[model samples]
Target: MATFATSDQLLVIIDPAARQTDGESVRIVKDVLSAGAAAKVCLPEGPEEFARALGRRGSRRPVVVGDDRALVRAVTLLHRHRELAGCALSVVPVGSTLALAQSLGVPTSAVAAARTVLDGVERRLDLLVDDSDGVVLGALDIPPAPVRAAAVAEPVSAASGRPWLRTTYRSLVRTLAPRPPRLAAVPAPGPCRLRVEVDGATVVDLDQPVEAVSVTPGSSGAAEVEVRPLSVGAEATPLRASGRTVTVVGGDFRYRADALVSGPVRRRTWTVSEAAWALTLPAHP
Candidate 1:
């Protein structure tokens, strides 16, 4: 087991969802953190209490025991308070689906992760800050109208297996029935009219319609921007750019950032902030 510098003060914020879903993991986390440090635990029932607890945390290092959303909440709160640059946050993956924490090099298991809290090193990372001061630690994607249409029209299985039976019956009827008359093709919806600019350079003008747009933070302090155009007869090429800032202007458009969907606004700009925050992760061998 890795050893710490001893008697490190820690503030453990256990999300309510973590307590409800995995009591055992929560107990393990509390136990391990207590064993290694002067750990003070906080069980906030909701967002308000959660915020209050952190605001009163003093100088203790904050350790979150929850899933990805919980981690994001803590980070967002810290960022807003202007304390993110000074704090090195730690997380114990206590609930289901901790892909974000794991991808950031945190141990998935409760015991290993809690141990990491005591023994891990801090690593600085970049962030995408929107015009509204909202933060995105991961990729942002904007899909075309056709993709949304397909998602909406997709069918689900019924309790009686009627969807499967319907498919089978339709297949048999098509084989036995007479040929039906063909119908004319319906016109597809027009592309999204967006004016995309990267580092002040226009990638897609207002007249140039696009299929999708994605922005992600690259390793070299730049945001990777991609603008996919609507396909014509053949495959359509995607316009790509990388810069410190990206701005998109259009009529009420929405985009997905990480797991959250945001906008329907006329404009949004994302600027890359290099090494804006730090996280505790296991040291390399």
Candidate 2:
């Protein structure tokens, strides 16, 4: 466990979504931080304000008060400015789902997380940066078609019994859909054709259709890649690889990176940067 100076200053940014949904948790977080050190709080109403708050943080360590998405946004903003390496972050997760935060070793309860923020040690962590300069702090997945097939069928079934109407409704739904998350992976409606490569070695050629794929930052300064092929019998063997870089090429595919969903791109490549960022966690006893 690594320690920090008790006198260290902190800047706590509260995500608007958290404020809207759980004001009590936000208040508790602020009180805990205030009791510990010289802390400044910023409640950003939207994305732009959130970015600006971090940009102006000066020398204070940033402590995010929200869920996984909020933490990702902060990391991405810091990474863009190339200031991520020099700063350590703390998180007090307050939202519906905290899978990403929990995976990172952050405490789940409001009080426990706040205490961690105030007294935790700083630890280095790896990150995945894609070709588009996007960042993923945890696992990235390309799920099988069956995972989302029923979802597509739901809206169609709800439209009516007419085939043409169903087709028209589906088209309309596609057209009206909002743009995917800018830096996160949003799952596609169905499976896609993809060719995966790790460290320049081809793992899955486009000729053979794949069921799914996943890429995660490995502890040994490498990216862990897994390719799940379409199974014919009981189960099919998965191909796995570990390397500094992983690339995928296909028609258009979607992927889930940690808690956020992104994509519908022709191709994307991600490289692991060892110990690229730092986070706060409780000191080991």
Candidate 3:
């Protein structure tokens, strides 16, 4: 655990998406943070600038004002530079998507999140690091889910009060809407044969076709893995295991890590880095 003084210097990096998504909230966050601490704010125009700003943060603590993707980008950049273990990060969730931040105990409101940044305590967290140097802050799913098309709505004019509200409403509707029933004539997706290994032991092999696979960083310094195999006449039970390392081998496959999707690769491996990073959250959260 780590604690910060109110006078601590801060490197506040505002993500471009946040500014565009909710300028009012972003301004509120900036105002609150500036009033609470000695902060240097950086308005990066793109990912390159974001990385550079974070890399040059020096000794000041980093406080990201954006959504889940921005938080993931900051963590990934720091992890790539081997600086994650030494730095504690803070986030002020101020964008259209904030599930990751909220799930991690971050306050959703701009003023509340800003206060958390000033008065929060640092807590070390686990991470899933892939062979390709990718990091997953939340969960990882194999065979990435198909992206859903958003419900079409009339474009909000300048008279609209808040664009973010409209966006949120659309997202809520999408979430609560019933998924279309699969047609009986159309065959379900056939499972892919993949070899999954946990630690050094094989949990599933190519002999068994699997419908899906999921991996999440466990609280006990390991990875919780589940493989759902395909069954002919009976429902197949998911094979589950926990280990420090997980490797999957098969034909080209894709995976979803946090918010991004990657691969069409034949093989991939992920290892658990116990308490590999730290994040600042509300002191009592």
Top TM-score prediction, candidate number = 3
Per-prediction TM-score to the true structure, in the order listed: 0.77, 0.81, 0.83
Worst 10 residues of 1 by lDDT: 146-155
**lDDT tens string, model 3, 25-62?**
88888898888788899999999999999999988899
How does model 2 fare in lDDT? 0.84
Give lDDT per model, in order: 0.84, 0.84, 0.88
Off by over 4 Å in 2: 1-7, 144-191
Native-to-model Cα distance after best TM-score fit, residue 193 in candidate 3, in Å: 1.6
- Tens digits of per-residue lDDT, candidate 1, 1-285, equal 544443388999999989977888899899989998888899999999999988888888999999888888888999999989998889998776587788778999999999998998998988999989888887787742322221211223352367678787668867997885565564544568899999899999989778889898887699989898878889789999999999999999888776566778899999999999888888872
RMSD after CA superposition, every candidate:
10.0, 9.9, 7.1
TM-score of 2: 0.81
Candidate 2, residue 172: CA error in Å? 34
- The digit string of per-residue lDDT tens for model 2 on 26-52 reads 898899888877888998999999999
How far does residue 62 in candidate 2 sit from its true spot (Å)? Answer: 0.5
Q: Which numbered prediction scores highest in lDDT against the true structure?
A: 3
Model 1 TM-score relative to the real fold: 0.77
